[model samples]
Target: MRVRTDSHGGHGWERETGGPPGRAPSAARAWARAAHPVPVLVVTGLTVCLAVSMGHSPGSAALVALAVFAGQLSVGWLNDLVDAARDARAGRLAKPVAQGRLAPASVAGMVLGSALLATGLTALCGRRAALAHLLALVSAWVYDLGVKATAWSVLPYLVSFGLLPGVVTFALPGSPAPPPWLVVSGALLGCAAHFVNTLPDLADDARVGVRGLPHRLGAAGSRVAAALALLGSALALAGAARLGGALGLLALAAAALTTVAGLLWLGSGRGGVRLAFPTVLLVAALEMGLLLTAGLPSGAAG
Candidate 1:
């Protein structure tokens, strides 16, 4: 029996004899994998935490969580669907669509469904909040559609993440804007995440002709860029806390330690390279924690 493999890595029936291919993964399982659950959960959980910290009622926080979760799911599914061919070519079997376990059409349908759900949910929050949330979702979709392969790839991350705080703050009674420091810190962290996230996939990306900013920077350069961005985010958060105070000092010290640890790991050769992404995530979490602790200042909230 001669087997044929499609571009999506699906084994086609034999050319000589009509026979069934191997069983595909169940739709539910494939859809779950295609949704990129970890990042979706992390982003949604973080948004909910931000809403709660900003004094949102439990119901408001739950709404924020649901909207953000649906939005993230759409983003994740769209990304997989858009990159299905590239991922398959690069042997990225971890992606359900690339492995042929999930159909691109199914992913596209989920993307539309989740995006509409997110939009409707955000609208219930208020006009300003809905606008901010919708813009963020659009920015992420732009990245997935084409910007991820361009030099301006990080632009979407900056725009999306920077607007994230507003998605919560604007849902407040007055629809107040988030503090400038919070927006700046979020943008910096998002930039760092973009660089760090691209590190592991640099090779595969290059193979598929994706030459984003991180890909052009190369591995070591991307690591340095990520470190610098993290430091900048830390400083932004510290400023928001008013650097002369104890809280500010604590934030600075923690930031310094995290940056140093990440740098050391980067310099530790191949064995420690695996720690890079986790280290960046740790710094991001630290920045978010500091932002939560600082809360919304009276003047800033107004």
Candidate 2:
């Protein structure tokens, strides 16, 4: 049996020399890949955790998770659909749409469906939560539409991520506002994520005429910015925890060590630049863990 490989570098589909052809399974895989599943799952998981921590009922927490998952799906799909032409032009065949393994129209349809589902689910959480999430979604859409190529690229991430905690807190009974520290920490971490996420793609982005804040900062500067943002986020969380009487010294220590190690690794000239983003992610996870343990506002507790 002979297999037909996508010359654009996408997953190869199975073709028989004289038998039945296979395209469905590979196409499905491509669709899934195009969804940007990793970040979608991560964001959804974090929302669920925050909902549970904020004293939401099990049903409400589940609703928040489903809503966030749908919203993330919409955002991811729209990103791919909007970037299809650019990706194709840049020879980014790893993108299923760019490689012709998936149709842009189909992806656009999914984007609409998921966005509607997300809106409906968020409305069920309550008007406040719904409004906050709607704004967040709009911010993400703005980034996909055009802000991603400009100096203000980080604005959307700051707006969207800072609203995330409020999306959970407001869904709870009485609709209490999210704590200031939580919002600040989330915004800083989101900024760090933006810088780190853009690092490896800086060259590709430049080739495609995309020059966000990170592009302007250059790689080394972006790395430093990401590290500082991560450290700032950690400090904010730690300060909140300290006010709550938990000290948070351990988490702060860990974040500091992780930041130092990451910077040192990159500076060692051992091709460790790839580890920079992962380091920021690790600090984010650590901050989340601290938030779960000692950073939850008393008013937010069930």
> Candidate 2 — which residues are off by over 4 angstroms?
1-22, 241-248, 264-271, 295-298
Candidate 1: the clashing residue pairs are none
lDDT per residue as tens, model 2, 97-212: 66666656677899999999999999998999999999999999999999999999999999998999989998887888988888888888888889878887788889988898
Residue 24 lDDT in candidate 2:
60
Deviation of model 1 at 43, angstroms: 1.4
Instruction: Name the runs in model 1 displaced over 4 angstroms.
Output: 1-27, 241-252, 264-268, 297-300
**So what's the TM-score on candidate 2?**
0.88
Residue 67, model 2, lDDT? 97
Note the Cα lDDT for every prediction shown: 0.78, 0.78
